[model samples]
Target: MGPSRIIAVRHGESEANLAYRRAGERPLVYGRGDDEVTLTALGREQAAALGRLLAALPAGEEPEQVWCSPYRRALDTWEGARAAWGAGPLPLTVDDRLRDQEQGAFARLNPAAVRERFPGEPARREAEGAYAFRPPGGESLADVVVRLRAFVRHLERRADGRRVLIVAHDSVVLGLRHVIAGAPDAELAAVLEFAPVLNASVSVWRTGEGAFELVRFNDVGHLTS
Candidate 1:
């Protein structure tokens, strides 16, 4: 069986994201609706930069699968990068499963306030990584992994020896990296020590034998002038 590669790219910044406010609530506004957000000026530029990188890849190596979070930001990222891969008129597949893990009652709150109000919850989430803590009415990090794993498994089976691109949020992106790296539950503790991935940065992974391994981690060289 041929090895399959996946390029996981985080979406450009969103207003809530930049503000460190919650995002999973209030409905996703960028990708699916007629009444949604347009990219911020900086976000547009980031998308263009990501597009150029996609354009520079080898011929026939263009991404064959384009999956994105249902969020508007992720949708716009994929849309902006579409032409770079000669994918005009290609529909971007929206995956709710790829949405950021829900923030629960904290969805629209300031991060600091959430910490202060739900002190213990934040501590648990921080200590456990995305898997151990669940916000009220939201999911735990373990919940996210299950959905992400299903998506990854589906992609592996459908790769048909082609590259895949996914545009999503920071939590999802980071969680994927950990999952693919084969880090156990005990290892989530140290995973966040690495430099944070920037907007539009890309990561690469290959899957085999029910496992995934990292080929590249947070490559943003293309974003530099």
Candidate 2:
């Protein structure tokens, strides 16, 4: 029996997100480690807005346990949300498995940079497809699913019948969708193309009739509202 409800959140926009956006025609290079990236001002606001939404949930629906990634951006996002929550701290656990997808040798390199650095990688990735394409020393989306599968099993064991909140990265959110929905590998590409996970988006899953159903996917109503 897994948790009755699971609320999965992607960390708000980070400096890296901004850099990637501004890297038009150039290779975007992040100065620090991925785990060290921090949230932008707008990201903080988005997180606070998310917090307000979570805080407003009915008592019975409120999260009982919180899980987060150890990455700085994720932690900071949670802090901002918790402040806006104003309901005092919840039981929080930081887990590395919730961290973003590792790019390995391709870390901090944009498409152009990757091509320039490793001329053959782009062709290789194209051949392998996005889901199965594993970067050198990094993880593929399939690899992410492997770890997320274990995490979901752990959640089911420890959080049976409870409502839980998870604050993590975009990859984690997508991975959770794949794991919880029991979707096939072929469907992931469609989901990626049709349903891009936005930063600070909220996704909810609820258990019903012995199975988990998606209540929402990539919801940004809190920010828009």
How far out, in Å, is residue 202 in model 2?
Answer: 0.4
- Residue 24 of model 2, lDDT score: 68
- Top candidate, metric lDDT: 2
TM-score of each: 0.80, 0.96
Worst lDDT run of 10 residues, candidate 1, spans 26-35
**Compared with the true structure, what per-residue lDDT tens digits does model 2 show for residues 12-64?**
99998888888866977778789999999999999999999998898788999
What is each predicted model's overall lDDT from 0 to 1? 0.71, 0.89
Please estimate how well model 2 matches the true structure, expressed as its whole-model Cα lDDT.
0.89
Candidate 2 weakest ten by summed lDDT:
187-196
Q: Which stretches of candidate 1 lie above 4 Å from their native place?
A: 1-3, 21-38, 83-86, 123-131, 206-213
lDDT of 1 by residue, 1-225 (tens): 323778899887665555443443333322323114346667777888888888888876567778888888888887777755555564367888898777677665665667656778767777756547788887776678778878776765666576788898777787787776767867764666654767888888776676566778788888786
Query: Candidate 2 clash total?
Result: 0
Q: How many pairs of residues collide in model 1?
A: 5
